[model samples]
Target: MSERKHIKVTYSTLASPDPLLHEYFDESVVEAKAGFGKTFPMYINGEERTASQTFEKRSPVDLDLVMGYFQKGTAEDVNDAVATAKAAFLAWSGRPWQERVAIMRKAADLISERLFHMGAVMSLEIGKNRLEALGDVEETADLIRYNCDAIEQNDNFSRPLLSESDKHHNRSVLKPYGVWAVISPFNFPGALAGGPAGAALVAGNCVVLKPATDTPYTAWLLTECFRDAGVPAGVFNFVTGGGRSVGQTLVDHPDVAGVTFTGSYDVGMHILRTFAQGRYPRPVIAEMGGKNPTIISKKADIDKAAMGVMRSAFGLQGQKCSACSRVYVHNDVKDEFMTKLVDLTSQINVGDPTVKDNWMGPVANMGAYEDYKEFVADLHANGDVVFGGKILEELGNGYFVAPTIVDNLPLDHRLWKQEMFLPIVTVTGYEDMDKAMKMANDVEYGLTAGFFSEDDDEVQWWLDNIEAGVLYVNRSSGATTGAWPGYQSFGGWKGSGSTGKAAGSFYYVQQYMKEQSQTIVG
Candidate 1:
């Protein structure tokens, strides 16, 4: 009814004495800038540099520039970083496991002391609310401590039995992979990078990390923690740059012993293919994207179901790989449940994450916002827009899309099957539980699935029929804890991921190195 206006925003940064963390950037409400001028430092061979070559980094919140001038690594930089890590690993891996565990424990303690600062940076750089950002920091600290505990208790040696001879003995133990190249993405930057890097370091391997160009500051701060913990200068290297050259350079290097990646499926496959083509093949642990699905049954509590769906669909702006975007509700309650869902969606506060009442923030980048717009347009063309359908133009430079809910879609619609990484959600109705289960399992993705029901039989059916690595019943699918490690068994199956449930666990020790059995007779 009235013309909308731009709102100026102020960003506040976190600063503390802990080396493991840094202060959040201060922000305020103001006319959004046409571009952000922030610069990121690249850590290579124990040195920090902002390379002459740089890339632009913009925040999706209001098209306001978050950071620009990210250091782009060249082939030479990659080689230098990798060489440093390789050289350090040669000596580091030979150190006693107890010493390695001590270093990891110190790093974990340092991270704990600096949690608030690190959390602030995560919120500032990634646009997550303070609470969610704190969760990320705490979880990261727990992961580091978990790895240390894992290393400490892993010293038990395997013994071979001698059936007939009393003078025979055999044993085995865990060892580190030489040098690991860790490439992480923007979403959950700390958790993804920290999990693999911490585990590798605890197992006695040095790492070379290439943080996402959009969010490299947090990794830089984390690296400082490693340094404060007495990790040797060359033991952990952080390189900030474009993925094309830097990613390939790291994966293609012959000396790097292994690779750990978290991002999209297409990129993951490309890395895997390149590694295979190279004569030197190595282990790669990759966590790709997911198109998580949800089902609401007639026997379920529609209110609880709606709440869970809202949290799962809009949490982290649906940027997480495990965010549930697809919903299949039984026809009996579809109308009733849709009403509650739409009301819940309308109530979500779409504003700055720092605001106490805000529930959703801007998407990560313009590209992501454009993708959300395109997907919603296509969904509208084929179906009905039940609630939200347009962007909030008042938020300048910020890419803010209303929480969208669409229904009246066919089983095979584009929005129903594809992964739309945004706050938009689509609903499909099924009359029968069997049919609902079938439709839920039809997508190529097998990352995560959720079901809401009071009947034991219905829950069991969904669990048995769903083709996902993670399944949830009567609760939101996005919930996870330390016991879960946020890392699935090193790999996933189907279009969702690769490898098996065999990696990403403490058992990953077996994936990186070979077990040797030694027998001695006197």
Candidate 2:
């Protein structure tokens, strides 16, 4: 019971020497059949707290309890965490700009060191593949380093104007919003948490972060990275709990100046309403869900287009908000493309993520798996399943949904309109460009959209007309570059984003800080 399960860190060609990439194991993984179950301590106010109740953590791939932790957070715990963040904010906000830069660079280095380890943990805990997990970690570290450099490079030092009789000179600097908090979701847990944590820390604000209940380990490891980087003990904090209490506590805390969140649209709206009615309403940046669309042009390359659509619709089991849910193919190429798409999708291997060749893994949990099953069933009852529309029954233990493609579904079909976060892809053929554009813009949720075309004019037209925040041309919707942390200045228009961007552009950070200009006569 007192033994730690350790795994050596494996690095890809992209890994750096920072210890932040080191793998962590259960120093003492104990399983219980009944009673209070097992538990892992919570990180609060720079110390680990062992409470009375246990919070069980499970692996998505298998219904096994990977690790469990104590639900040590109470109202008092919240206050302590917030107060520590507030106390640290005083000195952090007043520190020299260069000092902040150095600290942030150190943090980035630490994260780089632990990139591979963090990636593996994310893969094991959340069921993301090795490549996807590594990509998230690499992008996170790069984003932090980039932001640190940008802030220093910008060096917004105001210069005094020349005058015959000058009364005063002034220098303006960006200041912190004191105590900030981040409540992140399970999908992209490490990247989501790291984006806000690194950004807020570099901006000289103290943070208390609450990771998703299902994926808090990534956040805990990230907290270790901050600690290893020599971030002030009270500067960064982590806590895990149910959404209702922990989320509301973070949002409504008087000492908490700002909140960065990413989750569903409904919950995001609830937070907005709650904050509006509260005494201390701070800035909240939330990246909600989306029903993204993908467009295929008549003259597009059929093979490439089909492959792109397949990956976008099936990769990561389509849990991503940016996943291509709706695909609009030109009528001229619809028949050929659909056939090829079905063939390509049918060939995808749906199994465990550990398998090097397994193209698709199981859904995150039983609820998600059930939802996907119900969605496919509904689609089958209402329309037709062109290629794959059923779950692999032989695949036991894990929540495995077959890579499915549905055709002949009307625009008003539930499958077409819904954000089916599963391996379900719906196709609609368009005769004209105008009609295609209308179909793509039909949905209320606009997070991302993809387009495949050789014509420059058509690409530009879709780019100009698409309602999504992020649009792609001649590429699958899954192509997210390292430069984009998915939370930066870009956020969806309608239901996807609130209060500007999430990170890497200072919009959310800028919201926390107050701005004022001074004028004087000499």
Candidate 3:
């Protein structure tokens, strides 16, 4: 294999228009539309199987554009997929760690090579800009590489321990779970799903992947990368459909050994409870939602704070689980910070993601669009909508809304406390830093949070007091956003995740395996 290229990848870097990237995206966009009405089949047991029913997937950038027809898999498909994985488990799990690492590394290489095409599909299907879309795919590749690296560095978690006597030898080995169900959400079709899927496969587990209904194209392409990397048939399977039949069946299946899900709090907790009641408890790795907040101290740089807040709040139409949904500023800086935030948000270009110049694109679907409208109405009833409180119907056929900012809502307001998952932010003032900390930590979510403070004491205090799984300090790129795979080891605290262990970190792989102790007496 060739040495991996190190690129300084950041949102700012990807946001800039590169001629090569643009050309590749432009070409792929044309190619993606060729077979619009053709059906996309699910891969089960290494064979392409057509479902009993199929659903249409249209482009969120333009409702007139049809992305493709996707199979609406059912419970029987999930059962068959799981059965295939269960059959393949022993053979896959028996392979040496080095062999598994090599195959996954190859898969990562394929992801890198196909980044442009995948990004274009993401942009068209999920309403992501070129840069945000590209970053998502690139991150997927990096996640696979990181997990493979983890396996090699830890020697596949096979370690020898201190033996009590000379007559005995003691060793600890991390063995693979029988089969894992990977249920991914739409927000991050590539990275989130591919990241966890790679971790499980590298840890020697077979998997049945059920991608979200909204963005199965990117997920299926990802499954192709795994297959082309020479992953044996039945070791990996892809099934697509609604959560009720396909998703529920996969989760509740008796033979499935473990599960990794990335979705909402209600669904995540449901999986947690449902999986626990089975014959015996199984590991349910979940990274749920976040109502992340950003703090601006009086002594902080107001300009930098505003930039960070706006970027994190409006990026991907603020659909991110870690998107900054709330802000707290010192009373002294509230006026200045709000002005800066409004000015920056007002300039964000909202249009088709396929177009190179638009920074903000449409929301994912009508549900999010209607949610934005409902939230905007609620904001007007309870508080002051300082900037951008209307939907942009003029922005063409897709689900489009303006970047919204609000002020003067009481901290107790549901708008202040709930995760809106849209291009909306609510800013409130606080005279006391301690009080602000209390308000920030009051939510049921303890996902990600950021602090913008120049004072060493206050920074330390916020770090100590802030109840977040991922924390950022004064990041202009994104205050409460941007958790890279290897660099950040992103996860959540409290209700944000089932397992507190950060993904792509030192301990992430262990979640996919069970430990066994061996003793040999000669």
Q: Could you estimate the TM-score for every candidate? A: 0.88, 0.88, 0.97
- The sequence of per-residue lDDT tens digits that candidate 2 reaches over residues 229-331 is 8788788887777777777887777778777888888888888777666575577777887788878889798887887788778777887777788888989
User: Model 1: which ten-residue window has the lowest total lDDT?
Assistant: 7-16
Give the Å shift of residue 375 in candidate 1. Answer: 1.0
RMSD of 1: 7.0
After superposition, candidate 3 runs with Cα above 4 Å error? 1-9, 15-18
Which candidate tops lDDT?
A: 3
Could you tell me the TM-score of candidate 3?
A: 0.97
The lDDT of each candidate is: 0.72, 0.71, 0.90
| Shift in Å, residue 6, candidate 3 | 10
C-alpha lDDT of residue 417 in model 1: 75
lDDT of 2: 0.71
- Give the per-residue lDDT of model 1 (tens digit) for 102-155: 887888777766665566566656777655665566666666776666556666
